[model samples]
Target chain A: MVKHCSVFRDKTELEQGVAKMAELRQRFKKVVLKDRTDYYNTELPSVLELGNMLDIAYSTLIGALAREESRGAHTRTDFPKRNDEKWMQHTLVTKKDDTFSLSYKDVSFTKYEPTERKY
Target chain B: MKIDLKIRRFNPTTKNGREPYYQAYSIEASEGMTVLEALMSIAAAQDPTLSFRRSCRSSICGSCAIKINGFTKLACSTQIIPEHEKAHEMVLEPIANHTVLKDLIVDFDPFWKKLDKVKPYLMPPETQPEGRTKEVHISEKDAEAIDHAQKCIMCGSCNSECNALEIEKKYLGPAALAKAWRFVGDVREEGGRKRLGRLSDDHGIWDCVRCVHCVEYCPKGVEPLTAIERLRSRAIQEGIKDNHGAKHVEAMVNSVKKVGRLDEAAMTFKTLGLLRSLGMIPFGLKMEMHGKMPHPHLFPQIKKIDEVRTIYAEIKRKNKNAKKKPKG
Candidate 1:
């Protein structure tokens, strides 16, 4: 799933990652927590956190697939240039139901306008 | 190379809930592979039930410190099998002087409790003039005193390995004391002698027996013992000499300076005073009966007693010169 998003995150790969994540999310329901005693039980917390992490991964993959631009970490081979008009905005993922909905918000800035990050 | 990794396992739900037992596993290791990696492999493939705390494969996180062959080390940084111990048996256990929460993870509550006693944060300056809200400058010498102490990652290696903490749990161990020094040495900190006064109390700065384990096992060379000594010296410099810690040191120093050796008879009187030392008469008689206690007035003169006074004079001269030096 990580490879699908990170390795070759074009439209096709990210779409596949989103699908894989959607499928994998259900399997967590079957995860039986071994350490029930809870004396510093890292297993229980980690498993519970995995659900949140999967949601984040799913959101990241969806956002990467939708934002077809070569911004910071989202490097799409198909669309290599930075998109300022449509894609230079925050992708807000809201989860009302089990499914997440993505919305766009304008990048708020005045003095330091969005430009290529120079070291 | 395959070496036997004996991990100490503990679970409250187990049949013998109170008894902790070691479970040995043969794990494959290579050159430069860390003890954390070995434990990771063991937990991953051999036994998924194995429990340990680990984060950030690098030593920066300070989470993966455990006993590697009875020595406290950050497992992430320490190699699996050290060169000296090539005979194949590598024991992995929880850090000492802490309760084991699981297999290799010790509960850090006791440690954090002591650490919290010494206010770990830099207390805000007493006054920040409203007009001047700029960064304050500290001399390099001031920063240098605290540079080594500030490097402490609070890995609890020093706390776990501390011999003093083993005896008295309340003795705020070396890690916390070093952290105390971190703030106390800061020229900008306004707390100043007030913090030292708190630390000079019972089970504080004076409680440290100078075991030096904290110095040896500190993954970063924080030299917590040195920090404790610095705190002690600072405590003395501030003329906070009424405390037992200072008095004991003063008594010893006076005895050595006078007789070129510790005069237990006179030193005890100086340290505790004649009135307070009344309680120690019984113990003193036992020593006196054994001919161990020197007569207070008829002191046996050591050879070259003036040599001891010379060292004391030199230190006093240096201290005078140091005071004369300009401050930032």
Candidate 2:
């Protein structure tokens, strides 16, 4: 229930962003209530609202998806294992013309050697 | 079980360009085989040149801390089989936020330097007796506090995970602050002010962004964030309000105490002390532009302010009770 205002260049862009977020929220609510699944199970929206309800471009989604294992706050019950080799790299999600792409970034091996992650 | 151990190695004397590179070695792991055991086997069988530090094989003597997989943990403590499910690969490297001395070894000088800055020793009120010093009696409650502090084995795991250290290199990370709290909370310590004063520097207590990374990473359950918060409260109570960061903390506390929630606009204004303080005016305007500015009239109220007050009061009461309880 967080709300924020963004200065849109034109009404159309603002409308597009709001509409997209509304649709995304509806899909999210549906998944939470009925499907018992997350956004990853279905098609991701072009816009994602983060923090105190500011519309973020869908660029962050690919990175989120690339992380197959659930760690920290990023929980994916379906994929509930830490896959180090495939998913160790940091996922970078970029946006270009209403589309999103996912890329992996290698973790700095200088200090921390990733070991058996146990809480 | 066979486990592939990938260890990062660096040789200082041998080559001009001895960049860090990974060396994978196969090791047989038993049911209770710790990462340290596997490492020891590798050193014994394959590579004697491999270097790392480990004193107490148990978690106590924090010398064997390193990054395993992607997290910081003591090699002596971490069991290997749980980490290796399918591929059976274990990546071992030095602790983060430090220069690697060699393979799996990091320079601990910087970490110890931060520890030294906090004056990590208790200074009691009365001097000890001549020749034979009397053991200062500590109650169960005070002993609990001391125990929490003493749990820190100086592993530097929290330091490696600290976000403040990532941004501000000079910032005194969690381990030192927790060490500072170990002294500050000690009822025997007569010079609490001196300890508080030491943490009042630029790269000291004020620089913490409250990221809670230290709290998350500390294996000892020592909440360094809580320690930092307690230190802030003590600092404020002692009337040490010179720095901008201290002033901001005070203002936030005041706002939270008065109103149930923080008045962000008021906090920003009070923190700067004036409308036209250098760089503040435009920053304030920029927030306003971004619609991030909170309206003073629209102070967000917590529904159960009394509940919060009661919780805080109960905590204070418990602390008082603990302090008053006689030593056994």
Candidate 3:
């Protein structure tokens, strides 16, 4: 998941990560805790956290796949230029009623406009 | 290479952890795999029940302090592969001098309490001049004094390995004392004398036995024993010398000053004073009976006593108005 959503990512990497994450979520249902006792029950919580991580990972992969431009850490080798015409917004992932949704909101430039980043 | 990890696990509800027993797990060793990675992998695949505390995987978090082969170390930094030995004989357990709440997790309440007693945070000045808010400008050299101390992530590694804490729980452990010195060494602080007075009380700064366990085992290289020594010297310099520790230090210095060697009898009397020295009469009689007591008058006079005084005079002249630099 990390390699797919790394510093240099593309459409194929995002799609592969999204598919692998879906498989991971399905497999995570069978995972069981060896220690079910309540005293410091990290075993149960850890499994749940892993499930949550898979969900987040899936959402991130989808968001990266949907956005077709290079921006910040989500730089793509295929789309190397920042596309302000179509992709100038914030990617927000939401979960409701057991379903995951990916959407974007327009960034408000109240103080400073988004200019070309220079070293 | 395959490595066998013997981890001491404890869970209040389980039979295997009723008395805290070791559980062995054999895992295929990979290059550059840390002990923390090995434990997490084992818990995920092999057992799914083994418990330990870890985070960051970097040394900054300081949450992975565990006993590995009788030494407290951060598991995230310690590699699973042995450097010299063929198979890394791994034994993981919780650090000592703390209440073991569960598997590899100790109760940090006592440790946090000690830190609170030391007042770790820098205090704001009592009065500020009208309308001119400015930064306390300290030189780079001045800030270098506490650079190592500032790197402490509160791992509790020093507190775990402290021998004084093993003997006397009331004694302020190394981490807290070092923290006390951090503020005391800062030139910006306004209350150095008051801080030293409080630290000089019972089970405080004077209680450290100079075991140097804190110095040797501190993972961050924060030599807390050196800080404790500095605090001791600062306490003496500020004239808070009524306690037994300061009196004993003074007695030794005075002996070294007057004669070329230590006058044991005079030093003892001065340090312990009348009432405490009277309690030592039985021990003195025993020493006398065994003919082991070296009488002060019987010792030969040294002709080179002037040389010792000259060295002392030079040191005094050099540090005529020194406050930060300790006197010997």
Candidate 4:
């Protein structure tokens, strides 16, 4: 989960991330609080923090999987070129259960026209 | 690398004043590990009860501002290694001038209340500038100034270090005044006059001591002290001079111009007039008794009074030139 990031990774690493997520889910049991009302009753990490990290990691990997173009920091060897016609807009992804759904929002341009990057 | 941490702990739900104490821990910190990450590591490994507010892990949330080595800063952005001074020990405490709710969490009620006073929102003009169909047009220059103030993340670093707020709890503090600048500097806001008027009142912009601590401590480089000063000058420019702060400053400037140095006696007379100046006699006598107010001889005539005047003139000219330039 910690090794997963969108930048400069290809299909193999992303697939490994998806599999890693499932493996972690199977290996790590959910923590239960001894006293629900007492914030300090738990062990080192409260269940809430682990839960947030699980959700964040899941969503991040899912978002990376849904994107197919190389734009900004998202470098995908599988989709080396930016498909501007289809991928010019933002990729909005949502996860329900294990399924990922995607949508797009148009980029609003003002004043200067979008130019090719040199750097 | 192994680093030592001394974290100040205060649990308001259980402890009171003087009960707060520091707890030491050792953590293995890697390269590029932030102070926030270090704290998280300690909490995850050594202590579950350790408390601090955090969100976004990134600096945007503005939740993890704490005093590290007596300076208020965002924990998320402050790298641990660069801050090491005493071998590997780092002292962490809740920010000053705010009530500590727990270990490192502070009650932000006062901070929020002060910000609420600024009406930190736009009150648009009744009629749009270009016409009904078009959105209000703010020249790039004006928008740039507003954008600078908009960088404030309300991290409370400025508030924690504000000397003015230390003395006057009611002083709007840096974050709120900077927020006020966003609205006052906005060309679309019709209530610029009204907003400036409120800020000109007591415990407002004038209350800031210009210590520049806010500017130094602001992570966003908002330069809140500069914003408060602009608010003061703007108020005077708008002919809203019903403030003692404005009067005191104008009197000081005029006095300096006339005498080539501060004529405190004359300045006070002009600032408060004869009656109010007379009312200050008791305080003046106390100062005299303490030998703090040595009898003043005419300050030796400045060697280059003309140069002083020329510098002032140059500043005025530069200000006029800046006003004439097209803002981007």
Clashing pairs in 3: none
Cα lDDT of model 1 by residue, B1-328, tens digit: 8777778988876676458999889877898888898887876567767788888989888998998888899999988667326634688889999988778888899888988999998975678846655676787877898999999988899999999999998899999999999999986777868999999989999999998999999999999999999999999988888877799888888788877777777777878877878988888789889986667777777999888789889999999998897544
Model 1 CA lDDT for position B98: 92
Off by over 4 Å in 3: B83-88, B129-134, B298-303, B323-328
Per-candidate clashes come to 0, 8, 0, 3
Q: Choose 3 or 4, whichever is better by lDDT.
A: 3
- Tens digit per residue, CA lDDT, model 3, B1-328: 7888899988777776779889888988799988899889998789877777888999989999998888888988888786215434788899999998888989999989999998987754588645646766787887887766776778999999998899999988999999998998886776788889999999888888888888888888989988888889889989999899999888878777787777888777888899988999999999999996668787564778889889999898877756456321
Worst 10 residues of 1 chain B by lDDT: B80-89
Model 4 lDDT tens row, B1-328: 8988999976544534238989999999899999999998887778767888888788898999999988999999999998884335699999988988778888899999999999989998776555357665677777887776899888899999999888888889999999999899887778989888888888998888889999998888999987888788889878888767888888877766665788777677777878998999999999989976534365565677888888889998998998897432
RMSD of 4: 6.4
Stretches off by above 4 angstroms in model 4 are A1-23, A26-30, A34-46, A52-119, B14-18, B86-88, B128-137, B286-297, B300-328
Worst 10 residues of 4 chain A by lDDT: A35-44
Candidate 1 docking band: acceptable
| Model 2 quality (TM-score) | 0.65
How would you encode candidate 1's per-residue C-alpha lDDT over A3-90 as one tens digit per residue?
7988456888888888899888888667776656656666666677788999898888888888878887777999988878878789
Writing each residue's lDDT as its tens digit, candidate 2 over B256-298 gives 7677778887777777777435557677688889987678788
- Record all residue pairs in model 1 with backbone atoms less than 3 Å apart, i.e. clashing: none
Per-prediction TM-score, chain A only? 0.89, 0.48, 0.90, 0.70
Residue B105 of candidate 1: its Cα lDDT? 83
Name the DockQ score for candidate 3.
Answer: 0.71
List the candidate 2 regions with Cα displacement exceeding 4 Å. Answer: A1-119, B86-88, B126-137, B275-278, B300-328
